[model samples]
Target: MRVTVSQPTRRGTRRSHGVRAPAPTVASMTRLLPVLATAAVLLAACTSDAETPASSGCDPALAAWADAGFSGAIAITAGGETVCEEGYGDANTALTVFAIGSVTKAFTAAAIYDLVDSGALVTSDRVGDLLPELRGPVRDATLMQLMTHTSGLNGSAGADHQPLWRADAIAAIGAMPLAFAPGTDHVYSNAAYTLLALVVEEVSDSTYREHAMTRILDGFASAGFWDGAPAAVGPRAVGHLDDGSTGEAGDFAGPHWALDGNGGLAMSMPDLAAWTHALFTGGVVSVESAAAIADPVVDLGDGAAETPGWVARDASAYGEPFLAAAGGGGDVGHDTMVVWIPSEERVVAVASNGGDVSAEELMAAVGPALAAGDPIPAPDAPGGTVDPDVAAAIVGDYRLDTGGAYRVSDDDGLRIAALGADAVEVLFPPRDAAAADAVRTHERAVADLLAGETPAGREELAALEDEFGPVGGAEPAGTIVADGELRTYATLATGDGPLLVWYALDDEGAVSAVEAGAQPPALDLVTDGDAFRPADPAGTGPDVTVSFAAGVLTVTGPDGAVTAQRD
Candidate 1:
């Protein structure tokens, strides 16, 4: 779960090959070992959620990012004023709202340049003559290759709140199969923005959320779309999760059809800082539809490119260049980001309805300390609180010295959070005792090693029948532990299909270590000093350390330390 959204948007800087690796499996080597498997990185398990009392124009780096626990809602603007609207914990940067995922594809690329400045639509319109029950090649893509995501359309026509409508999301993108051809290459289509909200409901006869709240957010006084059972009353915010709990709040202002016009908006933070100050100065759509919605030659490499509702980049961290976009916590817990900055005409915009900071990590922790007035760098303090009898003396079972076996118990935040419903990690200190086990015994030792029986401590395992051939049993999939080692999980059914595995038993329960294939693992963490170390989401982890004291526990890493005790 090494997630990353910014550090110059990390997808391995430029993947010509950098971040692909894996293939040699065993559930990708036990998810490359999350610090020996306590499997870290799943934060949102907050300790700070209610703020706003500081005053004197709050901003000591957003109160050291809500005293390090983190949470969101910010505003910022510049050219025309408003340099910093607040809200930190429970988020109220002026009344909440959130759910702005996929930053609604830069407002569906600014309503296709506000429907080509009212001439209705162009960009050489096509999608087979405006939605004619689309058939293949993403119905001959055009409207500038579905407004720059390069329209070979392949990212999905379903499952983003799949309630399905708009003729079953245009018959599921006219029955898939074209991840290529259309304007030749680029892919990130939410079914090409749900066919550009069904080409703005077939040329504005209306309803793609009423032509995006009256013509691409008409005057923008609180932006629109997102009804989720909303007749109106205001102060939204529900969201939370990442361990924090309560999720999805928008309910549906949505012309549904899988979030129409791609990832529906809910907005608010002074209407995303007045729609990034009316889409960079000259007002929303004109100078040739905002220069074809700001350049977009594609690239999307480290210098970034692809335009249409944002992502122009150029190495910011506040060193200039911007025009970004981000939306909710995948799996919907809510988060958003906007950023504009055309040479400081500025606009920052960050949103969250809980799951601690992540609106591009609170716009990279408050846009370069509010563009250098400086103060937001606080973060390190959370590596110690667990008293209630030292979390009942560090829960139970341990064993280690090396033979591996740990099963501590007590952190009742109930498992199930492998993350992404607004990811963040690092919430330690809730009276510890966090157990976590229910063995499928590595799916009955991968169904007795697919019936050929060789599962006794893996017996030099590794044949994967010529890299995976005939296979079909084993399923379970859970359990991890690490340093105080456990592993377990399952899946297999191979013939080149499902794979994913990870067995382990040692301390006499037998089996020892099994390994197998297919990608898996996505989670969170953070805290270092007396030794606690994983705060990921790219805050960087894996040096490993962990601690505990009197009853023992230890951990260390690079495969060296270990410890345990508590039996």
Candidate 2:
């Protein structure tokens, strides 16, 4: 989902376009005796090695989600001590490693800063200067523009799992026209981070992995791009769909195109918490560079600003100051949300492996309360106890992920809506139809929509094929109940891109509404307004998966074919 300063993000449709998740990082610091006295004094403490953080409170929403089938880890650190760290559902609270999605950009930004610190790279240098082979509109985009996501790039040059080799990845990005002139506007472009990763390779004369591990990732024992790690590093969590079943084992061994620099690292929560602490406390980069990395260098307006690694907001936006960032692969179901309250020197983070419960949603439920030091409800407290007065008071307009305008509020959780109406779009509209026809029409509609036949944004959408690549046929991916509708999805493709198309049908076997993308984001629930719940239409449970009753399913793969039926 696209998020702004007014709300939590890195999920919704952006993530719904969902590909990968939030990220992790950490390290110790040696006191720096900078020439300036003030700088030296500040560095003396902020740059000291990390002390173990402390754990303090419990959150009722976390408990609610955990009981609701959310499986993930959370890490919170404050005053150089652990606050609360726990794993929920099937995950090991202390040992499960997760794919930390866009959170990885924090490190990419850090690596760039470290290079700057060492006089190896300059933020003002044009991206093209470092990688001459890059011939896209962003060629002249300064490194600063890239870090701030103002390089005129929009999302990806290809799918999150395309696996294009390095040369091809570079060529793909180089060939795409920038959405606008570099430094002219802002769009969270994952491809830009991949390009930055390439710069890391070119300037450092080493792999992004090698350089990051040695320089920026010095203290992260298990945080690195997903590849083999010693057994002690920890077991990686499998991504689960909103349904309790159908968890996926992630594949991070890669051609770093989709995975690099943007959102490709995996690590345990402790490592992730430590990384944020280290970076913010001056244990990672210099204080000045850390500030640049953590705070906005470019203003995106609407209470949002782009920093090297985060999306920052002043007190006016969130009712308090915070530096926020979130990421997750809609496809993998691995998600993370992080909020650093600079005033309290506290970091609150949530990571989830279940698609049904997004970290963004969970964080919204608890982060603000945790920050305010509000009374913590009992872990067993029912999800319905949020004060109605507070809920009403919280209602307001929001500009969320990708800058979508929203009428939003939170009581149970944040819901986006049209002012005073049920204009919220459904994730999967209701449907009842023959399987063959649904599949056929769904595929055609997707290609046609992305190919620019859709009326509203034809001109703007004309180049989608360049970013996600030309559309191809689709295949059944999964099924889940959404708002009580038996919604279904197909693993759609665009140059082997892992895109998704979800739809619902009417009683007469006609499609009601169909949505497709890497993530159209909260486009699913946002339209529901305050009436929406993280539950089914019956208001009893999440919109999750349901097995067919007395129905048959077919499976055909390279090995053979099989059929299953209700006994």
Candidate 3:
């Protein structure tokens, strides 16, 4: 049996095939004078025979970050006292606003819990009960299922490049077939959260943004919804791409309002720190609701737990209970992570503008130090080399279940083209003429380029630039081992920011899968003379193998064999 799974598209020009959300400093305040004075006296006494007294600030980890070329803001709070608060490079914690990406989900989830507390909604209520117009399997899903991404709904309704009315988007999502039976498995669905946001609007009789502003961010400083418009807010740090280019928050592609419930919040590091603090301290929601947000409701079976809005991991590293939420924009920019240690009443929030550093790395380096209130050593750099043989075998054509063919070319270091509608359309259906035209142009350009017609392809690419903006070329980034698979990363520069492409190979070293913009159909077999064998057979139908002849590919698995022709 051929099983099709819906994959969520990362918003922005660079799409990540893998699910990795991608990380700071400081301090001076008159209020700390008393503490500083006392510390100075104690330090002087201890160092009476020494030449200098120890500094009052106790964050060597933060100082180390500045030394490591970190270019963002960081805020750390412990026991209701501001432990470390500082900015690095171009970031200013007091003024520079950064897009928090999916971290917005936390605020949305908190709002839902608040509604439940107010007797306006319930976790058990079916989606159909709240939004009667939502049809199909999704209608039978409970709000809790939606919150935990177990709604069985498609991972995404589609991307939002064109202007899409929320009502119409909801209806379109309702029309999509469920990936599986509701509540049976785990699939991250931004569409589910978007629907939940609609539920919030219906229940509160206000827009999702409005509700969030009033209920979630009313008291926070310098935070607001990012509607994909140019930054009207000043002092905003532009997101940096892998190509060393910069663009305002809205410069990245994708629908802004459409990502509202799932992602779309922009704020400063201090504001995010404040929000997390308020969230866990019963300031935004009741203590019970807050606790529920951290409680793991779904076991991903990968040692990761999914809560309403946070991802929970083992507390062994922190030596206490820990919860973290992360968000990123497409591939190489605007990454943020917030970590909460409930037992210690500690919160660590980090935000970076470029992909050079990741929140996970920052947290890993700082978590131990923050927990111990002393700086620890920095962790090793992430990345490694791909097997030369594995890299050579991964060049070919792949058919996507969502209706497209991904062509991987080894001509000049692995370039790719989408034969039909690119994956972007699968998640974000074109709602306007411009979006539709762009999609067509992209398809045509890829086709021409794959055929080795550089001039014509470049012409089409130029047209795309005219429609969009300056498009950057793709370059090799690096490689890493994920889930026991060695995947290569490539960076694509766009008007918005840098996007990364992840290519996965099968056991036999064939290009078994490619995830960029949207999920492509997995490649199961590669031609070996006249015969073909399973490449990545795990989680597939059967172990049977077959042969290819007469320009047709025949695949036989346990269930049986099927024949398909090149498109």
- Candidate 1's residue-wise lDDT over 1-567, tens digit each? 121111111111100000000111221111111110010000100101222224423344455655454566666556756655677676745656666767787777787777778888887788778888777767877877776767776545654553667787788788766656877766555667778878877887776777777766777655675545322235766775433446555564343676667676776676777776777664766777776677756765545567775656554322445556665543356656565656546665667665434444434433343344444346544454444575566666555543444444445411112211011011111112222112233335444654556533242234554566655566554454331233544555767787665544322122333345422332233335555455433232334555678777665655456566666
What's the lDDT of the predicted structure labeled candidate 3? Answer: 0.54
Candidate 3 differs from the real structure by a C-alpha RMSD in angstroms, to one decimal, of 16.3
Candidate 3: which pairs clash? Answer: 14-499, 23-359, 158-427, 158-428, 159-427, 159-428, 251-496, 400-521
Clashes (N, CA, C under 3 Å) per candidate:
29, 49, 8
Ranking by lDDT: 2, 3, 1
**TM-score of predicted model 2?**
0.63
What is the lDDT of every predicted structure here? 0.52, 0.54, 0.54
Q: Candidate 1 versus the native: TM-score?
A: 0.34
On the 0 to 100 scale, the lDDT of residue 120 in model 1 is: 82
Per-residue lDDT tens digits for candidate 3, residues 236-275, read: 7667643345544455454444566876678887678778
**TM-score per candidate:** 0.34, 0.63, 0.59
Q: Find the 10 residues in a row with the least total lDDT in model 2.
A: 24-33
Cα miss at 365, model 1 (Å)? 12
